[model samples]
Target: MQKKTIAVGNSSFIALIEDQHYYVDKTACFKPLLDSGNFIDLITRPRRFGKTLFMDSLRLFLAINPANPGSTAKQERLFNGLKVREDKNFCDKYMGQVPVLFLSLKGVEGSSFEAAYRALVQKIVDAAKMHAYLLDSPRLDEEDKKLLREYQSRDFMRDLANIDYASSFLKNMLFFLARHFDRQAMLFLDEYDVPLAKAASRGYYNAMCDFVRAFFDTLKPEAGLVLNDRPVLKKAVLTGCLRVSKESIFTGVNNFSINTICSDNVSLSACMGFTESDVLALLDYYGLSSRKQDVKHWYDGYRFGSNDIYSPWDVLNFCQCALSSKNPLEFKPDNYWIGTSSNDVIDEFLGFLTEEDAERMQTLIDGGSIELQINDELNHSDIRRHQSEDFWTLLLFTGYLTIAKHAGYKKYLLRIPNEEIRNTFRSRVQVRFSVENRSFAAHGLKLAEAATRGDVGGMAKVLEPLLKNYVSVRDTATKAPAENYYHGFLSALFACAGNRINDFQSNAESGYGFADIVFSSGYGTDRLGIVIEIKRTARPEELLDAVDNALKQIDEKNYAECLRRMRCRKYYAYGIAFCGKNCEVGGGTLREV
Candidate 1:
């Protein structure tokens, strides 16, 4: 693979140009969105899926329009010969037509609610000042200017009284700029839901919602009137991970239209990042076609609509890793997506999860679907139900997930989209639930002994506790605990074994059937293989019968196909039976041939 030329993060502009990493062309994704002459369309996407970059590209495009004599035509040079320019009609119709108001609500990591609200307002004011400059309006009188300066000088606490009216100030600013510019203003608000998310996690959601409602109220009716009169106020485009519903913020704004992940009118999916062709080109460029399957399995399954998509951030990061490592396996996945958001929210949610919820979570993890409601209210108290096949759907819609499929909805399946998200979720789950140490140490030790000595009885003894503690009774209407319980036991055993006896895998397919567990010793010298079978028996004699049945199945199914393929000299197989917490272990009783 060739050396990578781009770094992935919010600091792409600074790093992409300065660093020597090769960057792929992602400008094509934004072409249709930018070229289309739509106004007031909101695009919602999951976090770290390139929402910020899309907005940044738009900002760059509009700031450099050639129609405005004062605009920096030189800045327009950055986009010359790009995909947007390919559409001659769009370029002529929309290019350089109006001034753009781009603002991001992402930097509100305040120490307190009041402080954060103040900081958020200040960001708007700062952006407004840029608009003021662009409009060059003398609408502010001397007294008004003095008041604005005085308001800016006060501390957050001292300014709290006037903070309730901060929206009016911003509204007035937008109105003044529209009148001054003599053209409709296009507002691009990026990460518009940050404050709500921050407040929700902090238990200050009410305050944040109130502030936002007031803030948005200033933009509507009043701003609409100004735009109607001035013709300069064109449209607004808001992008965020979550769409705070109108009922939640702009309660009475009947003119508003929301283009969310579910919206069919807006093709926002393509705007956020590259498609499959983009990834193939990059992979081909790097001469890493040999690892194409691995790349697809690990990072290639995000779909946002009718089109299959990949997270641009993950693709870039993968490219950078492949370029640096001759072996793709050496590349460590980073949880870039989850790292972008505050962990407190996810941690809190996980902490409150009930056992039933955890079981449901497993189903979601195992590609099962569940119904969830989307509330349009401020508090998310109302529920609008939708069927989702996996947790990936919930994760993507809630910013924890991303598009893994783009065909019709039936073809989509969501996983932890990239290395970044997988790592983040792993870390959060560990931190939040690691304290609940269920006593599996004794069981783990016995299981290890059984594997070492090929003692089926010892294995049964250890697995008995697992069956009692983890498995649900048949009376319960739960899905069969095949993969979930087995995997859990394996993980617990590995953890308790002090990481010494590694190289364990389960569900190895054989000619006749599949083996439940096949654990091998990590040490090359003390080689061992152990096969385990689990059963629920009605009587003590049934335990022996279960063992006999397992042994027959093992041979009939050719469970040793893999071992035979490797030409191993000797192999160990054990059969185990469980009746609730009780178990019996014994050797395989070969059939008399």
Candidate 2:
């Protein structure tokens, strides 16, 4: 049994098959797609959810060899042993029998409208070159061949005047292929909305939207015609992260069907992501079955149309690390999904948070949920308006949040999907709110003053109010203990406090053990040092006991060793215990080192 290689970032179906990379069979999605009556299908999922792979696989499965039309041998070998191979009759009807045009808009992004338009034209020319054999067809006249030849040349692609025909490039290509094969072509466009998304972020949204609208005009029924008055487009599938409204770019295409994460279409639900069984089998194949719980905790909470799915990107990267490690079991789960993109969506979303919205954000980070109306079809322009409805909708569709449960008509209880996403939210929340620390600087200063004076009760009073208002990380039994959450909160608080606090260190070395927090402040003989230990209690009744034990630990471990080096005449060692938003603080008597 040879080990199968994991394709970390590869999306090429043919290459993956030829190279024998481990793959989860999503070919079963083909049967439903064929049975679907819609002329154009738009499937939306978050980025890095295997949308590109699925589209590329579909392209090879249906595409005929343009140079050698009688070649099913190549297609057959590529799909061998996959689930779609089991459907012999269906495969015989459709496989290797049609001209397929596949285009990806993932790279069609730019800082300006002109730049983005040029990129799109390049994409059109690239797709045209894929089926260059159409130039040799006897059914096509010299004029059609001349047009394709122009499309293949570098001069036509670089001509700024050709921008006018950019929207119709694919349409003309479909016509040329249809005239040659005497069969309508199927179109598969991947990352269809990337240009609009990039344009919106770069402030050229309207210009890009108009261009996309014209490009989508090719999907209209009237535009799908060839020389013999036959429809050139038999079926089309477009993949993107969001469903831009029909009024925005996809105007008047009645046959356009959408399958989003929230849609009830069960067929495409498991296609874009890996199901539990898919992940389990992958783990077992690599002898990492013991890591099932860790994998599920970090990557598995996405609910796509009533089916639980794990991010395929996260799963593959995790498996790659485990397989390369000497001790797979000791490998800890990581936030693999965060590095896939710029995470600008989360940043833009946090920028619009009102104080009221901040409370809702707190709820989500604390392992709870917030209810809101989710609009699956949102225009790019709406995001510019900073509409709360649009922001929440974007968050849900972009994978920052998932539906815990459907509430009323369009309302949903949305929450952070898993530990990986939750961690992202917590870190972002800390950064976003810390910028507005001036709002609570008074409380932070009071807490600092209390800590310097050994006033434990006063410190608790200051933190209690701040805790009630601030966003908190999840503190469930399955998660890292709440102590870490409190530690970050206090660290941020002390950092923002006035000049009274200095040389702050968190979880730094002390006497015989690591101290949760150590700092020195004041000057000359009035210079003082402080050491703090933090704890979280399961029940409120144990708050005082937890505080007592924390103080005892500090004393036993001589946490004041760092303060002694700081040359402080005296120091205070305080113990803090938090139970939910409430807390208890106690400290040993101030003493000379």
Candidate 3:
């Protein structure tokens, strides 16, 4: 494959196109959103899923100045040959035709509302500089000009940074932009909840909430004789990972529309992430046709309004690494997206981990689905509260998990989305809670190393703690015990080893039928190919019987045939049984569950 540039972070769309980066054209989303009747929109999607990129694109597209020939021509050239260009009529009608007031509160981070509020002020300062040409506009009255200058003034910002003034300040600013440009303006708030989330982490939720709440109320300013009037913003769109409730952010704002992953909104469903076709176009261009299925398995399970989408950032990160890696083998689909800013909220969530939290996590990790009361309406403080509802909802919103199906009546089935996210969850559990002991990965590796050497006692050491702490009692959605839970527990351990083991699999074909688990050592795999059969019974008294039954089944089914097929120098078979938290193991040399 020839070399290709790829965007890794917050680079410009124009830069991505002009620099010849591998671009996925999601321009089809532009027109539908532009035409959507809702005047104010709140689009909630996980971070790094291209929310900022899409917002930036929207800002640039609508920031199109029809009267300014140079600016219009530049935007047209930037979008030339893109998916949007195919619809010339739509492009002609809407591209850069109005004023845009774009504000991103993403990077405003601090311990107190005061510090974080100042960071927000800096964004306004930057916006003022971008629109400084408005000062010379004949349309601006002396009053509007003074209002703009006052906002730009550092002293004014400092005075306003500490109260409700900071919240309603943007409303006045938008009014100024409207008057200055002689046009109603579209407003974009990128990472709108970031400051609130930061404040929640810092224990300033109330102060932050008071400020943010009043600020959002600006979108619904009353007008006319009754004074209960419409906001001046022609159209407003806000993007964030989680949806803070209308009761909080939009308090009195009417006719507000939210396009979240859980929504059936057609236009916005495919808006946030790159669709499968987009991914295919990218892979075909890069001559990675052979790895299509690999990418699909790892990055492509997210479903939004019947549209399957892949994380554009994850796809780009992997493709970039692939393009740069001299050896093809180095381009493994490890969780490259994890170490990015994806897990900061997870770390915040970690501080509140309890035993119940560990159990629920294990249940999800064990390939079991969790049913939680789905409340897409949430606030930043909700995540830090001691509530299971908050934990599951936050996980679903933040991309570690996704909705499997709506169970109806405010309940949703949630699971680890795909291999990429599954690996991420496993790694997180081991890394974060491995405190006071060997990190989770170390213990799993020690067990993997022992299993390779056929050390039953060492495997016991690894299996015991895992069952008690990380393994859940219930199995699948069906609530069966033996099969899914044990299978999930073993799969999770191997997954924690990461690339240490090759072909570490569950319910994979072998011998006469399928084996519960099997793998050969390579990265962390043992030279001996191993197959395991698992049995579950409710009676701890029958643990021995369960183990024996599992062993007999393993032999009768010839589950070890998969190992023989591998032609490994040696092979090991294991029959494991679990009854409650109790376990028994039986195999070629050692017996336990």
**Quick one: best lDDT, which candidate?**
2
Residues forming the 10-long window of minimal summed lDDT in candidate 1: 381-390
Backbone clashes in model 2: 0
Cα lDDT tens digits for candidate 3, 413-530: 8878778888887776545644432345456656676766667667777787777876554443364543676677677666655333556778887657787888776321224576
Against the correct fold, how does model 3 do in TM-score? 0.69
Compose the digit string of candidate 2's lDDT tens values, residues 341-446. Answer: 7655544455445676777877888899898988777876677676778878988888889989988898889999899999877665445544375356546666
**Alpha-carbon RMSD of each model:** 17.3, 14.9, 16.7
Clash totals for all candidate models: 31, 0, 16
Q: Candidate 3: which stretches are off by over 4 Å?
A: 1-4, 66-71, 160-165, 221-231, 342-360, 430-593
- Model 2, residue 134: distance off in Å is 1.4
Ranking of candidates on TM-score, top first: 2, 3, 1
Best by TM-score: 2
Better of 2 and 3 by lDDT: 2
Candidate 2's C-alpha runs over 4 A off are 434-593
User: Which stretch of 10 consecutive residues in model 2 shows the poorest summed lDDT?
Assistant: 471-480
Across residues 79-159, which tens digit of lDDT does each residue of candidate 1 receive?
A: 665676676665555555556667789877453567677777678567645543433336545655554554344353246
Question: How well does each candidate superpose onto the true structure, as a TM-score?
Answer: 0.62, 0.73, 0.69
